[model samples]
Target: MRTSLSVHDLSFTWPDGSTVVTGLDLAIGPGRHGLVGLNGSGKSTLLKLVAGQLTPTTGTVTTAGTLAYLPQDPGSDPRRTIAEVLAIADTLAALSRMEAGDVRESDYDVIGDDWDIAERTAAELGRLGLGHLELDRTVATLSGGELVLLSLAALLLRRPAVLLLDEPTNNLDGEARARLIEAVAGWRGTLLVVSHDRALLNAMDDIAELRGGEVRWYGGGFDAYEAQVAAEQEAAERAVRAAETDVKAQKRDLVESQAKLASHARQGRARAARGDLPRILVGGRKRAAQVTAGRVTGVHQERLAGAASRLDEAEAAVRDDREIRVDLPDTAVPPRREVLLLEGVRPAFGDLELDLDVRGPERIGLTGRNGAGKTSLLRTITGELAPAGGRIEMKVPWRYLPQAMDLLVPELTVAENIARIAPDASETERRSRLARFLFRGRDADQPASTLSGGERLRATLASLLLAEPAPQLLLLDEPTNNLDLPSIRHLVEALRSYEGAFIVVSHDERFLDDLELTRRIQV
Candidate 1:
């Protein structure tokens, strides 16, 4: 197939005064393309530009055929069922053919009737793992992950020439994400995908990195790009060191030359006073030497300036444009035994039981089909929900980190929020604690709402830990959803080191496996 989508010098700025994407040029053909960058780098914005959901302020985006976008958050589209939603594309096509009367009698024999099309559409839904899903189930009732998968199925039904996906793996489990990726990889059409999953990027033909309102294309895998970035950083560090050394050497030479010039002037004055025979000649020589010394000083200054320029470039290169530092406050708590216990706890909501028994030191993974009450069960354990019939006992102080980072006040600055959370601590003490969590100086003044998803998570965790009574039990729901790989690793390390019990719900298999889960509770 030929290239289906092309974007040239595309730029967009929101009315609220943020240039999300600028001077971006991209050419997409038939192979899978990966869009990898830090959050708010405009990956989603670029996709929106291509899909025509957002207009560009400059340049143009052109598509040869039909286009579709599967948004990261497939907002509530409630009138369709899982199966009906997937079949909409086929239904639309069939209706068009009937209204146009373009299907001749002979064409009907070859193309099959409306019933045949509907039957095959239903079959296709089954292949995509929605076979059991009722054709009449409302989209509103599905979980966030289920909605994402269903949206993909709907996109496939349309059979567009180009597909733009924004974090399609957002709410999906390991298996679902893998299946969705495999299906897209096998697709014959063009694909542009935005994802933070490093493993997924390895399967792409090329990657595009967005930073500072610019997009850089790398014609290699994730590993190659990472290696290149690392080397650049090392080179930058060396340049900085060399610049510092040159500055010091230049300053020392300047000091020595000034001293000699001063001594020479003093000697000339002595010779004049003595009225020595060759005083004039000595003056001429001194004048010539002074000119030469001045030229040498200028040369040294120029060389120092050159060194500074190189150092600047090196600093830019070593900045590691995509790096994000997430720090959580250090919390000290007394050792505890049996943080939480659930004995044959059959928590039910509307006659449907969600979870069974759960114990401490046991890593319980909640997994099931959507609407199987995974989240409901977690809420019950965290006291967010009142269980109808189950018994839950808690022995230690606990803290809950919701999936949405809802605990953070959106309007408050990072430092102010921290101070508010720990009201007993002084400003200096609060700032010191926040500094350990990497919210230093001006950074602490940025409102929590403006923070990146990872940053918000870090700030939230830091505030929770800095409370008067640190939590001994940490309950996290979908902890790794929007976090980058490095942030996720840091969080895992922090949790591992804490002398506290943890219960987390996530769909990432590799994450779960890497953390060495003790046991899995299928809800």
Candidate 2:
């Protein structure tokens, strides 16, 4: 296969002297590849480097042909029209002047052989399920899903040899995401996508994982990559077991050797004390016994040291993160408890209404397309957003976690934020609980504004889960929106151990499945 892009010894460092990517080497041929990694693992940064949006601190990037990049959040002037966003405004203006019979020679130069730009733009939009979008429409009037489709339409108009997309489906609804997946399925050029959207990644021709500052390629799509990693982890676990066994055997032998040496020394001393040999011979025997004991102990000690080294080598293969362990509180609810009641409730944002009763530890997934009343419903329940009409009765302590995770006071430290919710908790108790959430020492003291996407969510979770009364009913809205795959996994891991019932709003099918939802509700 011909390589379409290549990176040699690439490295990047932030202006604050923090290193993100270091000495990375990778190559990609003409095929679709999904790039995945943890939240701060530099997937977007690497895409920017390849697209020439950012200069690498070291190493070289080579591209065979024209490249176009779509950022996670495509920015543009709100007043710009669709034609201008597609870079065809000038050509259309010249075409109009030519048709009006007042065209200069420069107008013809601008139009050239690309006079069919208008039809091409319409056709691209139609193919992407956006035929209703007019070329003269301003960007500010579009929805989040529409904006994403508009960006894709712009990229398709250019027809670049290589296309790079970062989180293209972030805010896309079900239909919009499906449209994008269809477009991607028909793509023939070199494409690299970085996303946490599993359904999108599973459509790739191959997969590349950026872990521990390296890219590892796997054949086929997301499912294949998952199986391969599982195998690797299994092998790593087996190696750890064998190494532990060897270390134990070595320790046993060392103990036995020491015991034998002590017993032999006592026997030699008793034999000498009976006056069975002359004084000089007795002294010589004692010296010989000491030398033998040293040699025997040294040999066993060396074997034990070698075993310990082997154990360390074996343990290095595993990728376990014990510090981020999720410890569930003992707050499980009984099956007969009436947790919530929402009767004739109409939330602020959508046209839908709900009359429902939730009981016990139910895992409810509130699913719908973008612009739905999912968030509004959660807010109304929390009394943050009042209902247009109707009533909501909650019999349990409930907390709502919005997508932004702004529950904490940004100016305060994480520990201080926890203290706000759990005023009765001792300072040492707060620190101990925060440590389990991976905030130790100075990390707990770091201001909330400085926290990353994953850390902020963890902090929010800590605040709600460790509240004074201990929330029995939790409501989460798009909790996995900006999180990376590892962060998603961590969230799932934490939720697995949670005894409290929750209602989560999400469009991610894979994530919803992993949560083991007891029921799904449509708004």
Candidate 3:
């Protein structure tokens, strides 16, 4: 019943004069709350402000008890040991020094009540599926999933009353993500998480949507919020229809009033010509009619204006984050052609060894545990790494989309990125293809550095898929790792129409299901 975290009239602006959040207010109670928004909608910025990592331009934040934060990136250094990363190495060393008879007052001060620190650390790590990970092990040796779990283990060990996690599952594989979800489900303290993972959001006690500089509350999980949005949109659309009808009615009334005024004028002219009344009386009568007609016309015009304004307001309430809608007839694959063959090949970089054959239009789902080399196998298939043994035979043109999405040149615009890949294609042709990915008009001219995470990925994918010679076989590595839900959905929808064979490595089960995979390969 009590509020644990509070944000009051918070506002933040970048150095470039871009305002990301403005006059935002939110109160989070003691529960697992999911914070969601579009990629560039300032969800992470709000968390950073709440965690005191960034000072808001105005207003204040207050927490009921001790607070801790787990950032999206986690700021992990590969060369540092787990203890060092957790920021407890110095305290542990002080305790060791005291036991070694240093007898320093500072050592005693630092190690005062934390005598059980080591035991607590081990217990927390084990609880989070990190018991096998040693405190002295460097982060460099850990896989992406392990690194994420280790970071979370550090947060759990602190036992803070309030915990803030931003995109905690950014690059985690399914196993690591499940471990986090389990940990979240057991949280007893106030927890606010900003994540794009629907599965993670589904585990929350409530969902908060931050949009247009405001936070809107919804009870329960992602499904509940979606239902609420659907209802709200339905009402908004209905208001639009009513407003449109009112405008039409007002226009018709004005037209009828004008016709009557014109007929009255004609009758007055005939009376004046026939000298049916005194000149003075006729002039006064004409002036009165003109005045009345003007008043009537102005009244109708005002009503029409009000109706048009209402229609605009109604339309504004409707959300227009349109999905990518484009036809890719050329990307479709036939059902009976040989796509690729791999014979007893060991990757030079990863620990995976494989023997496989892929046929036309086959959508292969590649999966494995972290460190099992899902990415390395894809790299090897793309000739980025040599096979230690055996051979890879590609029966058709191939293209590889890596996990990092580094295909685009940072200085190039979306249109330019596509143009670089398809040098012979005309500018018009290149733009048409990019438009299919939702990059239209000036959006296609935005530099790669300026795009949001989702936009950049879409641009990079557009570039690869629209190459000079259309690729028949596509190799994708961890494609769903960092993509937001909408971007993931866009990709899934696009791939549905793709005729080319694709081998994709993704830990998102939801994404895998949406792809309607033709075959599955476990590395």
Candidate number of the best TM-score:
3
Tens-digit lDDT string for candidate 3 (23-130):
888888899999887666777778888888888999899999899998766657779999987767878999888788877888877776778889988887776678
RMSD of 2: 4.0
For candidate 3, the clash count comes to 4
Q: Pick the candidate with the highest lDDT.
A: 2
TM-score of each prediction: 0.80, 0.82, 0.88
- Give the alpha-carbon lDDT of every model: 0.71, 0.84, 0.83
Q: What is the overall TM-score of model 2 with all chains considered together? A: 0.82
Model 2 per-residue lDDT tens digits across residues 21-116:
899999998889999877657888889899998899999999888999998778788899988888899999999988899869998888887789
Candidate 1 lDDT: 0.71
Those runs of model 3 whose alpha carbons end farther than 4 Å from true positions after fitting are: 1-9, 13-18, 49-67, 92-106, 109-112, 274-278, 326-332, 348-351, 410-419, 422-432, 441-447
Candidates, ranked, TM-score:
3, 2, 1
State which candidate, 1 or 2, has the greater lDDT.
Answer: 2
Model 2: residues with Cα > 4 Å off, grouped in runs: 12-18, 48-62, 75-81, 84-87, 104-114, 138-141, 322-362, 371-399, 404-427, 441-453, 463-473, 484-486, 496-501, 516-519
Q: What are the RMSDs of all candidates, in order?
A: 5.0, 4.0, 3.1
**C-alpha positional error of residue 476 in candidate 1 after TM-score superposition, expressed in Å:** 1.5
